[model samples]
Target: MEQVKVFTIDELMVATKNFKEERIIGRGGYGTVYKGLLPNDQIVAVKRSKFMDEGQIEQFINELILLARTKHPNVVRLLGCCLEVEVPLLVYEFISNGTLHDHIHNIDGASWYSWSNCLQIAMDLANALTYIHSIPIIHRDIKSSNILLDDSHTPKISDFGASRLIPLNHTHLSTVVQGTLGYLDPEYFFSSQLTEKSDVYSFGVVLAELLTRTRPLLPVRQTDQNCNLAAYFIQSIQEDNLFDILDSQLIVEATQEQLIFIANLVQRCLSVKGDDRPTMMEVAIDLGELCKQPTNLSPIEREM
Candidate 1:
């Protein structure tokens, strides 16, 4: 655990070109992230928080404290911070290859969308979750867009504005439910009791997105009336229509065993009850085993 560096506002201003609009890379509930070039020629992501109220300040400091001590290969690294002004700014390592959402949905993009890549990314994220949970911290937000990619297309989990650190004796926390619409854990939403399993549920949704290359919140379609992806996915699996909703590329390229294995894993993860879901370590181990399986034969070819 290295100490987080304190950066000056002047340095940040110079790095981000005075916070120019064009430098903006991402915007979320907490703040906007800008692509900055440090004086040392290091490229970084500068997160400028949106509000300075008590609640907002709590999240900011929570993220700062949590990320300062947290260091994992799969999780985004918090390099420094600028607290000279009221609204604090955070600096993180810049991930060059954009997000998992971009690669999954951008069908025409140069990035590869192969099953192996998806599996690798999932494993990376699962490993990250396991590490974070071991520290008794809940990410609270684990979606495709929050997952950044390095130049090698490795997944790096980011965006900890909604994270929480659980006390040593507590198995769960009672807090106002906050998460993305499509990926939110239904149990947490209704009960307001957040557990690590909430993150598992969101990770399940991300896996579904990888297989389907569809948005978590599906648009209205002629045959499918359900707009929520988790419900749609579970329904499809139960109806034995999983293949119907899966990406055509995956159907052609992935083995039947591999697809079935991951589908079952995702289903278990998306269970309505948090207690029914597997731990992050379990998910990571399962994925590690799946990654070892050979991908030489496709489902279509094997059937033929």
Candidate 2:
């Protein structure tokens, strides 16, 4: 692997053209991401975090160490970093295809992404999560927005701000629960005990997102009540009415067998009990195999 060099604050400023609003590609609770052109003419994504407390600074260091040690096609590559500035900045290879959430939920934008493309993205994300779990790191935050896409529409896992490195001997670590609400593992949320399974659970939610093509949480009916898609999906599965909840587009294109396979996988991942969920490795392997099989033409039988 090539060594990543630290950039000076001045250099980064110049590359980003003084952080122009036009160059800003994304923003989140932690920071903003800007598209930058380096002196070498290489395009990169620059993540600039807001103010960091002592503990956050330590977590930033941990993220750096983790990214530096890990390299995989499905995982975002760290090009360099700029820590000399007031707020720390992380440079990564630019992914042109944008976030999975945009393609799935944003109706005003392009909508040509086929069901096959969605499947590939999900498989790629699974591969990345499997790699992270192999190294014993729990992402704690796995969502459509966190999975970036390259020019070819290949998915790469990004955003390590909420990640935790677990020791080999430890089954679970007690820490302040931190993650997006809808995708968070319920077990971890209640107990504050995190494990790799937490990431698996979140990834399961991502899979559900792909299948349903809906936001994690959405308003139901005329009331102020909100419905979590994950919880709703699990309930639908139990009632044998999963088709009623699946994305209409996906249902039109996907075969019954294929949909069942994917639904079963999602159901297992969303198991309220972490012990019942499959490992990331197992999930990845199963999805990979599914990718290789040709889609069958059998029609889905509507559940009575």
Candidate 3:
């Protein structure tokens, strides 16, 4: 792959039309993402990070270097970057379908995405995580919002701002805890030891979101504060009420056996102990097999 080239601040500003509000595609704690069209007519998604200190700037550079080195079908492709700007800008391939979050939640009034589609999307994400973990990179954040889908409905894992590059020889690395609360690994929260398993845990939450069709966090009642869906899921599983919490649409189409299998996989992933969680490779293999089975095939045929 060709090395990612850096763009001048003026070039980026021009491409994004001075970061016009109309071009804004996404926003987060770190920055606003805008859609840009280069002079060559190449479309891109540009991330303009918020104000930062020297340490944060260095970290952003490190993230760019890591993104440049990564090239996988399931991983978001980085076109280049602009570091000379007041806030570092990251350019990535424009994913037209937006985020997995939007599809699952239908926040924009779109029809609910199919359960099978959700499963396929999760499989693609798992494959990406497997690739990232192969190089021993731990993506501390692995939620629906971080997954961008292309026009073809293929999912690509994005947002590596919170990722940690673990040395091949090391089992774990110590760092100040950072990650979305609901999706964080319980072990990492307590020990402050970051590992690939942390990513596994977060992926589990994503899997749950796919199955349940609910946000990671949401308000429980008008009178009560919001609750964490992950915690709610764990409790439901333990209480033998998984079906009650599962998405109604998914349940209508899924067989009892298929539901049980997926629930079991989620259970294994959300294991309180990080060591008990399956590796991304194992999860990918299981999900790939699930995806290949004929959806409308009879249970007898599936068994055969």
TM-score of each: 0.95, 0.92, 0.91
lDDT of 2 by residue, 122-155 (tens): 8888888888887878888899998887778788
Candidate 3 deviant stretches above 4 angstroms: 107-112, 221-226, 296-304
| Position 13, candidate 3: lDDT | 90
Steric overlap count per candidate: 0, 0, 0
Error (Å) of candidate 2 at residue 94 is 1.0
Residue 10, candidate 3: alpha-carbon lDDT: 92
Superior by TM-score: candidate 1 or candidate 3: 1
Off by over 4 Å in 2: 108-110, 222-226, 296-304
**Candidate 2, position 255, lDDT:** 77
On TM-score, the candidate that comes out on top is 1
Angstrom error of the Cα, residue 76, model 3: value is 1.1
Compared with the true structure, all predictions reach lDDT values of 0.91, 0.84, 0.83
Question: Would you list the rank order by TM-score, best first?
Answer: 1, 2, 3
